[model samples]
Target: MEPRFLLMADVAEQLNVSASQVYHMVRSGELPAIKIGGRGQWRIERSKLEEYIERKYAETAEWVRTNPLVEKDDPDLS
Candidate 1:
């Protein structure tokens, strides 16, 4: 079974982002985390990561709904 909490580096590896990005996310309150140990090591809960992913999906869906497709010369836009 996976640990309930993971090191910041572990979370970064799982998310495929830089460890610094994870730290920034934690600092910015975009991702929930806890600092433990005398050196203030950061740990991210698995559930919080799942919650973050869900929130992103919801945000993206809302954005797509608010901004419908528009005619553009760029084929990628379609």
Candidate 2:
């Protein structure tokens, strides 16, 4: 295997967003990350990224359950 973890730019491309956005996600704790350098070089595992996405959707569902207004106002459901 080349490497299990991916660099910031690679992860951003994989998610189809800017690297700065990815960094923001990491900072916000939306995505799992690891720092490698003194300058705060961050990397994320591919598997962890997938798991993060799943967890995000799951959390959204849970939030809708507890916050019924969101589900009620979501026009896309009907």
Candidate 3:
């Protein structure tokens, strides 16, 4: 079975972003994570990652709803 927790690198790979970005997310409290060991390594729960993705999807949908696309032929472009 897959592990319940994932390393920062793993989360970055899944999200197609850099490891530092994941670290920033963790630091900024945008993503939930736990630090373990004497060295204090960060580990994110798989469920929390899933939740973040779902929340981003919802936010994007809302943004799209509020900001409709503008056509190239629209008079505002001229």
For this target, which candidate reaches the highest lDDT against the unseen true structure? 3
Better lDDT candidate (1, 2) = 1
Off by over 4 Å in 3: 73-78
lDDT of 2 by residue, 1-78 (tens): 658899989988988999999999999988889998889889898888889878979999999899777666779976
RMSD of 1: 1.7
The residue-by-residue lDDT of candidate 3 on 1-78, one tens digit each, is: 999999999999999999999999999999999999999999999999999999999999999999887887678876
Ranking of all candidate structures by their TM-score, best first: 3, 1, 2
Clashes of 3: 0
Q: What is the C-alpha lDDT of each candidate?
A: 0.93, 0.88, 0.98
lDDT by residue (tens digit), candidate 1, 13-70: 9889999999999999999999999999999999999999899899999999998877
Superposed model 2: Cα runs more than 4 Å off:
57-78
Candidate 2 C-alpha RMSD relative to the actual structure: 3.6
Q: Model 2 clash pairs? A: none
Candidate 3: the clashing residue pairs are none
* lDDT of model 3, residue 62: 100
